[model samples]
Target: MELALGELLDERLITLDLQATEREGAIRELAGLIDRAGKLADRDEYVNAVLAREALGSTGVGHGVAIPHGKSPAVREAAVAFGRSRTGVDFAAPDGRPADLVFLIAAPEGAHDLHLKALAHLARRLVHDEVREALRQAGSAHEVVRVLAQA
Candidate 1:
């Protein structure tokens, strides 16, 4: 079954933090989000592994958005966390623009296409600027999830 971002969040699978800076700061911020959301085993391990993946290529898909993901055995299930940088973070976005929306995803090493499909689903959902703006202006984490659910 296809899982909605908000549904995952409603299950406490995701959390969002509105305070974040650009580039490296975004990654650090995601670590805190994961910890608070209760989805990660080891905080640093999760953060480092994601960063290592970013080293290969920037996850920033431009248009003020970035999706950083990693596949590792440390994860118990596929999960995602959301973060917003009001000032926009320099995530090395291919378009050379700072990213205001960020999604951090972690999946088990054996999940295969499921992980990629989830990322693709997210990227596709972001095609609408209105949805992006709604996510940006959402007041609470629940609101964020609601907006995503609607989209």
Candidate 2:
């Protein structure tokens, strides 16, 4: 069976609701969550590596969403974590808007297709305004996961 974001998260390979002040801080917070979630071996090294990858190109695809992703030997498998900002964070989105929803993805270096699928699913699901609103109003990580599961 294909792995869903909720499932992977439930299995302890993901995390949610990371508080960050800026772009780099957001990425670092996500990396720490992923590291603590048991997907990566080294927290600081993994966070820095993903940050360096983001420096190559802005992952802020716009529409209040940013998908920051990278592959690393630190990742044991494909995983994703969601973070929401009620006030929005300045991500330098291509649309010239701050990002309210962010998804950080880290996959094993070899799991290219799985990572792509996960990204596509995240993009597709977030396209709906209702989902966005629901995410914004979501009370907890479980609620966020429920929203994604229903999507």
lDDT of each: 0.75, 0.76
Error of 1 at 93 (Å): 1.4
Indicate the TM-score of model 2: 0.87
Which residue runs of candidate 1 sit more than 4 Å off their true CA positions?
11-17
Q: What is the lDDT of residue 126 in candidate 1?
A: 94
Candidate 2 clash pair list? none
Q: What would the TM-scores of all predictions be?
A: 0.87, 0.87
Error of 2 at 75 (Å): 0.9
The residue-by-residue lDDT of candidate 1 on 38-126, one tens digit each, is: 66677777778888999999999999999888887776656777887768887788889988888888777788866687787888889
Cα RMSD (Å) between model 1 and the true structure? 2.1
Question: Residue 135's C-alpha lDDT in candidate 2?
Answer: 79
Among all windows of 10 consecutive residues in model 2, the one with the lowest summed lDDT is: 9-18
Q: Model 1 — which ten-residue stretch has the worst lDDT? A: 7-16
